[model samples]
Target chain A: MVALATQTISSMSNTDIEIVVDDPTAPEENSPAVASTRVVDIVVSLLLLALAVTLGWDNWRTGASWDSTGPQPGYFPFYLSVILGGASLYGLGAAFVSRREATETFVTRAQLRRVLAVFVPTLLFCLATQYLGLYVASFLLIAGFMRLVGKIALWKSVLTAFVFTAVMFVTFDIVFDVIMPKGPLEAALGR
Target chain B: MEAFGLLLHGFAVLLTGKTLLLMMVGLVLGIFVGVLPGLGGPNGVAILLPLTFTMDPTSAIVMLSCIYWGALFGGAITSILFNIPGEAWSVATTFDGYPMAQQGRAAEALTAAFTSSFIGSLVAVLLITFLAPMISTFALKFGPPEFFAVYLLTFCSFVGLGREAKHKTVISMSLGLLLAGVGMDTVSGQLRMTFGSAELLRGINFLVAVIGLFGISEILLTMEERLALRGHAAGISLRVVLSVWKDLPKYWVTLLRSSVIGCWLGITPGGAIAASFMGYNLAKRFSKDQESFGKGRIEGVFAPETAAHASGTSALLPMLALGIPGSGTAAILLGGLMVWGLNPGPLLFVEHKDFVWGLIASMYLGNVVGLVLVLTTVPIFASILRVPFAAVAPMIVVSCAIGAYAIQNAMFDIWLMLGFGVVGYVFKKIGIPLAPFTLALVLGNRAEDAFRLSMIGSGGDMKVFWSNGLVGTITTLAILLLFWPVIDKALTSVTRMVRPAKA
Candidate 1:
């Protein structure tokens, strides 16, 4: 039993080690990594603050007053806006205070590059669904993501993307009977 | 006799072909996810929750809970085999488990850990079966104030017991509460945080946030460093498993003790991690060969595994009896209960006896199935490590995208998932605990609802939480937990100062 337990634990550990090794943290802080992380934090915090302010302004302009009802529709949300705004401000403060001392940042350029590569394509895919319809846009989106982010060979990327899109289309549309958005492009293609 | 009859009815439901099939399926999928590093039990359940929408509620929950058990069992496999823990709870196992593997006694350690996990889960299940109804009956007297106090207690205990900095945990929890304030106020259909976008009206789905935090973030983190997939050369044999039975008797006492510790910790909010840590410490102190613990002692592997499994299973008890989830996974199960149109409160057992009993019965069946499935597949799961990271990374990402998209079939969820991925990455960078964030998100809405309802009932007076006897007791507990850290820190500092003076 002891040997069996040892073997089981060892096998599991080996797999975990391989996974952990991929992004093993350095025992000592690296200056470049630290600077990169701090910059990302500052930028993201600012973006969030801008979003909160814009949303708060929009809600204020709308005829929907927060006090219309016993508690207005915006009553709870107004508080959230303030809280989010506060959190972003705090994040900004931390970033600024830490910036003076050339401390290590968490976000590296490489990390940002990787994040944007996938994030941008995904955003575009969502937008495309509005114009190109679900199937056509999905195919294009997947193909684009594969080619750009995955760096697969053109043919392989196209084939894989197309196959996945087709399967999803069939599964959701045919099997599940859920209607998907079809854009002018899809209509023209007779899809 | 009445309880026995109900259990029989439960057995009848569990014995059905559908329930049995789902139990097996859940176990297999759970083991697969659990064996993978970066995918812990909660993540595994969240990733697979979408698949259950098409099934009956009882069957779906059975499968999900079974998957949870399987994941727990599967976690130790990697920890022992390669010194890698698939989950944080399994970290202790790697200390001694991997060393035992290095000594070529891998099969012995695997069997013992697996058996101990089984024993722990089974013990907890039995306790739940007998104790749940009694607790629910006692809880039936609670009103909104009591419920709110319970939530406060939960929050306080989690903060008090948390390993992370208290300030960070509070911040994360407050963020969750702030997010919960986004959707429409339940009492008065007024929109709270929509700003102007129609999409914001629904607020952020807990499932989406979870997928983003645990799944997408995991993918991004993996991309930072190039992971190598190395396979183990040795295979576990049945003969080896059986031969270790003789030594098992020596560890039986430790297993029982750890199981008790696991149960106690699991019952308390934020106790799972503490329970495992306590079990490990106790085991080390009690062992004769304590010096060999971190090096390769079998007791090291045995203690934590037993405690983790026990705590994980016991968390379900409070969820069933009190309508309060003890962990993120239980919170999801609570969502499942709501989707099934069954409210999980004191009335759950009385009003939906069949559902409650059937679920209990399924736990019994599912645990056995999980143990058998995980033990047999140890070698097969270990081989997955041989797959190249280049291939595995993309697959994981695709699965994450699919899981996110499946939640509400809304394009916005995918975007939300990406945003969460970014948050997850930042949290990782800052060394913030993701567990608290996830837990806060799961419990935040319920806490807000209880708080608002309690205040409304009391005419907006905060004193309501302390007015009733039951509520007062709970409030006192919450207050104590809230200030525990200050007391502990002061004591620790005083001790430090006094030690030198005494010397």
Candidate 2:
């Protein structure tokens, strides 16, 4: 069992080589790093490599060679996928070679927290838009962000959200008459 | 003279009250978007594009082009007063502009920047007026091989000229091409890479990608940085404008050189950001007082602003003439043209003469109106930046969401936008150039089709790209450009070796 685990680890390291080192210039920060640049680089390049392989395989499946009509549908994309794979390999190799960037912080603990603070809410807003509709979702998003993240007074946040939503409704629905996702509230207040 | 007569007829068509009103409205909206962080010319136009969907093509093009002009002018405001570049092209403007603002010369710097932009745009418009017809006529002779060669040249130029890593650029561009391939193949009637999703079958929309990449990614990036905006108060009066105009003639050579650089980059795909930096660098190299440039020299302000505006304006020429966009915003405009049921190649000149001329005429009129509006309303617009970024951030996000959904009126598009937003953020962080990615996405299928058509015609002969002088020259030039970095290095090394031996 121990021998098998050691062999598997060696194979994994050989396949996706990554070098982690300490940066001489990196500041001793309290926030700490969420991940090193080398790790992110390795992961991203590997993802790109996987994408290229999948695309290449799919294109090949769909007839990449030339036929009676000149070229097959997958001919161009297959070649493009080959180029992509080559580029991804170059990126992966560069990441492993470049020692200076290896130890660099991709993002700090605090920074990632802040990024997630916005990203999470935005994702929720998008999800909310599906059911609550655009206007209500927008109102909740604006008001909630301002109140929770921005730390504005409740009244002020509510007022700003209300006015903004009203203007959007007037502009998109009434003035321009562009169709948007409507919820029960909009349906209830029918023309 | 014939072009001039058509231009006058175009002016007549654009002089209507409704069109004029729309122009002003577009300009104001454009300035608002430009002054705000996380929003810019390309996505600004993208957001407003759906609004123009129902309008006449001429009026719609006029409004959109005016927004382009307005965004160009508005970028200088933030660069000069706030020391924060509102657009990528305006980053160089802050080198001297902010220092001038610190010395209480904000109004003068503003005037010079605005005036230089006007002159640059004026020159670009004139270039378009004369050159558009000639280029389109030339393009009329192009066949599939020639078209493929041109597209090859366009993509190769990005690799050759772009400052980003060559591997990264290749990756980004190839990724875009792959994304463009994610629908049913038009030629073979075979599904390419839909992954069994009905939504993917319709293909990824460039507009949605642009909004997410530019708009949503910008907000996320801004979130990473502390978003505090403090700007100098700009109060430009008639006297300030006049005084700046008097000093401007002293730097006429700088202005002229920058404009020329801008026009060249614009006509090519070097883009406005590259043009601005080149303009600034060239001006500094030629100036007698180079040391004073970063220390508050007005010439420093003049060089970049002029080049950026000139490049931005003239980028439309290729889009009009060759159906190839020279910049990102121009790509969006090209998309708008297609959405309007107007084919955008050489035939556009022959088929929609009125629409073509009217847009050109609007370019001239719009710049004049934009100059006056931006100069007089600088204070009001600058104050808009005073709004807390917290409030402004959410508003911009909401606008991006609305714009994404409005593209196809589908909820899936909104989700796709969010996905692209994350992708864009990561791409930007990793030093991959977004412009080539966008250009590839927009032009991918067309280039592929042209390639396949050429192959069909030549019975799969690889020499078809070099079969004719025109196609051969373009293909050879593209190959040369693709290896430009290597050639450039070799030439420098050879010169160094020879010089030492001679010594």
Candidate 3:
């Protein structure tokens, strides 16, 4: 169960390098909790604080003082980073002291599962588009989501996906002539 | 009267076959997007913006603004029938709209909602028609300090009036400013935060972030609840609309009050969501039958829809006159304005009178078109909601991906869009406001330019913002608004102490 939860979180996949956690209190399907609101709050605020510090350092290095022409490029961003850092600190402090939030679930396990179930597939669809092309990847994604998550009949999902992808291709590629990524299949078919 | 001549010229510009066809197409597409769960005005506008890249600026704006009016009308459909707000601003509509639907008055509720929206938009357009030119004329005199002060007030108002936590709003806004500063610095011609990536050189496109934040993140959020969109059946015949129109005059006070509230909020940064809730609450408070509110009252539907549409329409006024977007969708439209090689702000009125007046003219015609289209097609849109979310969600995702990729024909944008989507999901779940983030991102560089220019002019003096009376007043107002939450609490506590002593 812990491994499954970790896998789900890590499924963010090429989206970012945010920390992933294995919450022991991720709860059962019946219980409505994946992590406490306090924990998520602390994590997010800390992440923001880190971002603020990094940005502040970068802006400082880039020249944050006023020059002859005007304030330097980094002057504005440096002050903005300061505000961001201060706000993050305030958020962190508030989250730590807020007892009411400590009892609340950031997202229930069932809700997180539902969210991740769609998100992981979406990330994969984006990755797959690089190799398989937009239309093919989209067709597979829609069909797979419909069949697996929606629990629809196989033929219905396949048919729906095909029809949808065909309409999109016509609208974009044929009608509007908006250029999109085409793959080996389109290359083989010539133009 | 000069404004009248300009508006007539605008109508003449709009009286082309191609423009009318685009209007109808935009309305239909707008309604379709609005009826869906995850797609709203901002997302719809962002997704379709690229399609207008080659069109004339006047026609493009007309079509895009028509989509906005259509979305405003379409939001009422889901709120009335499905008890789900298709748009965030329409959430208040579900209070009485869904109740009326449950009482077998879905048609009546939807008709009232659409009619009120039409009335609201009409009033706002009238305000814009007469007021925008004058404001722009006044804004023509504004210097850099004044522009910076105005931008300061715009961002400050979000912190002051937004419902989110103060710190979260600050964090969201500053983060956007940071992101906006990532690419090449326009004045210095130096990279600020690109690190070393080649893709970062072009900067993060607002369109991609919009598609990801509003479009993709919305889909992910919708998936969290496993929606079953079993909704009330609605059949809006002409008779139902006529009856609703006849009954509408009885609640003229609610209509007028809501429209006023919407216009005020829309012109400020209070926004459509706040306007809707305030409109509903005030209507309920002022009504004799307040108890009937939230239980199937037609006035309940009227208040929120009217205010939402009105504010959503009027939010464009500031964007036109001052180059400051009053809402998220308006911000995207501002981005589109830049993409079309037309500068926003007061100069736009003088330079691109045709485009400006043409858009104003379309706001009038488009709302009428939207009202008629929605009244006849509510049933079709409501049924469209009956389609399974699983099927619809993926299609929306694909459209979003296409929108992102189409920005610069870059695959990197698609990946960046996915990243922003995850960020959006996390931010939303943690109650970080997205509106300020978007507005800040769109307006950040412009504001920085104004600030730096002011500093340059004033020899890096901090008092430059307060050097002149006009700039000083605006700067003071911005600071007051930024600290309004604290000041308000202090005043309230003081009032409480005084009242107790008097008692």
In model 1, the Cα lDDT at residue A1 comes to 3
lDDT of 1 at B252: 87
Q: Give the poorly placed runs of model 1, Cα more than 4 Å off.
A: A1-31, A34-191, B231-234, B491-503
* Residue-wise C-alpha lDDT for candidate 2, range B1-503, written one tens digit per residue: 99999999999999999999999999998988888877899978987887887789999999998888888888898898888899999999999999998888888889989999999999999999999999999999999999999999999999998898899999999999998888999898899877788999889988899888988888888666645545555568799899998887899999999999999999889999999999999999998888999988899999999999899999999899988999999988988897788888889989999999999999989999999999888877776665555677778778888888887889999999899898888888878889888988988889999999999999999999999999999999999999999999999999999999999
Candidates by lDDT, descending order: 3, 2, 1
Off by over 4 Å in 2: A1-30, B497-503
CAPRI-style class, candidate 1: incorrect
CAPRI band of model 2?
incorrect
Q: What is the DockQ of candidate 2?
A: 0.20
Query: Tens digit of lDDT per residue, candidate 3, span A1-191?
Result: 11111122232232211222122323245656889888988999999999999989999999999777888889999999999999999999999999977997788877788788789999999988999899999999999988887776799889999999999888888887888888888788885
lDDT of 1 by residue, A1-191 (tens): 00011233454434322222222322222324635556765776687678667656544543234232233334444454565577678777776676542365565565555556555665566567666666676677666665655554678667876787778667665665545667786577776
Q: Clash pairs of candidate 3?
A: none
The superposed Cα distance between candidate 1 and the true structure at residue B431, in angstroms, equals 3.3
**DockQ leaderboard ranking:** 3, 2, 1
DockQ of every candidate:
0.18, 0.20, 0.27
As for lDDT, the candidate ahead, 1 or 2, is 2
How many clashes in each structure?
49, 0, 0
Name the 10 consecutive residues with the lowest summed lDDT in model 1 chain B: B225-234
By DockQ, who's the top model here? 3
lDDT per residue as tens, model 3, B196-251? 88999989898899999999899888766545545545567778788888888799
